[model samples]
Target: MYNKRFIIPGLVIFVLFVTFPLWFNAFSTASPVPKPELPPGGEKECVAPASEMRDRHMVLLNEWRDGVLRDGERDVITVGGKQYRKGLQMACMQCHTSKEKFCDTCHDYTSVNPFCWDCHLTPEEAALKKETH
Candidate 1:
């Protein structure tokens, strides 16, 4: 036995709920793409190549974290014959200063909540919060 009358309403309710989050997110204001500023010399190159960094940053960070915490390593990474520190605060955040402008833009766009921010604060974000009365 089939109830065609009930089927249509049930499907409509299911679809509405299923798509509601996507619909609401789409209509919400989107943050602009991040344009991270370089340091005083206007140095443009990253320690690793840009394409590799774009795809493998998380992997590199995880490796660095493990090397530091688990192995008790001093966390020096050599890339392209140059040495660099492995800490996000030391290396990465030097360029990607504003987490709101840089990290949050892409994370929000992709709907990802990275654990990085939970443990670390960008230098710009370290400022004291203004209290409201």
Candidate 2:
């Protein structure tokens, strides 16, 4: 009602500031999400389909952890006639051998620090250690 000159500009500035991020990004091209490196072996199969693995790999790994540690379900799994041990080191790292190439790219892109390493070594390194010991 009062000070139309000052009040109008102040409201305009506040609105622009609030919407700046949305509008700024709208006019600019966003960086595309990085594609993860595939297995070096060129293996075409995974325990789950590619879509499921992309979206829910963390959940799947968590389930594996709980199943192995809590339920003692350490049995082998068969998929597409291939046998896989019910563990990360034994199954996953066999093909996804490089942590940086296979794991870190996507994990870094999403900015999630998974606690998987707290209790387990990078599975490939663990495998090497086992062989040497």
Candidate 3:
């Protein structure tokens, strides 16, 4: 009688441990189906004019600056919905560096001279001073 009781309890425990995991795995594998893409038969696509893009960019910049000042949140200035944190090299300076390719591309296309050096010193000058010391 003692042996039978122990065996029954052990068998119940073994079945529970083995079957529970398999049942969970089967349930988890039954994922929902994805939805279909929207039909492309719509109105003609409209490209934003250059002036409109510039105006929109200025509005976004103002909104970002306001959020930074008021809320102290860095989610204001986002690219592809990713927030950029404030830091010396991690902020806007990351892309607005003197020798970067992005600056040249805009300058070449717009024929506008970038007056970055008027306020900020060049990176080459900073490096030279560091080397001399």
Candidate 4:
């Protein structure tokens, strides 16, 4: 009778301590995919090939670097005064707010990391806080 009682409790304890953690870990395991590394010798691909879709991404990066637009303001960006809508509604912070989710999605697929983050803030205005403090 004593042997039977001890065997049942030992089996229950072993399942709880060992099997439960293994089951939980299988669902929580993350992918082993590595993040893209920075380029060398001054080679960078900020915009995709010169396509219509890529034009907006280029304009947005250039304008942000030049300090043309203020944060949270809707300034009409007209490339050559033609009123370019491609990049009009987009902001630097839109994708960069969640760097891992938004930026990593495309960057990981393409295997390139843009250097824009080196100098500018995601929201553009937030960089000012770092400077003042």
Best by lDDT: 2
| Candidate 3 Cα deviation (angstroms), residue 23 | 78
Whose lDDT is higher: candidate 1's or candidate 4's? 1
Better of 2 and 3 by lDDT: 2
In model 4, how large is the Cα lDDT of residue 19? 86
Cα error, candidate 3, residue 87 (Å) = 8.0
Model 2: per-residue Cα lDDT at residue 84: 84
State the weakest 10-residue window (summed lDDT) of model 3: 37-46
Best by TM-score: 2
In model 4, the worst 10-residue window by lDDT is: 86-95
Ranking by lDDT: 2, 1, 4, 3
Q: Per-prediction count of colliding residue pairs?
A: 0, 0, 0, 0
Question: In terms of TM-score, how similar is model 4 to the real structure?
Answer: 0.32
- lDDT (Cα atoms) of all candidates against the true structure: 0.73, 0.85, 0.50, 0.51
Q: Candidate 4, residue 40: CA error in Å?
A: 34
| Model 4 lDDT tens row, 1-133 | 5798889999899888888967776889655565433322233332343354344665556665455445544455443333432231243233234455555666666676777667545543566677889
Clashing pairs in 2: none
Model 3 ranges off by over 4 Å: 1-90, 95-100
Q: What is the TM-score of each candidate against the true structure?
A: 0.69, 0.70, 0.30, 0.32
Question: Residue 82 of candidate 3: its Cα lDDT?
Answer: 45
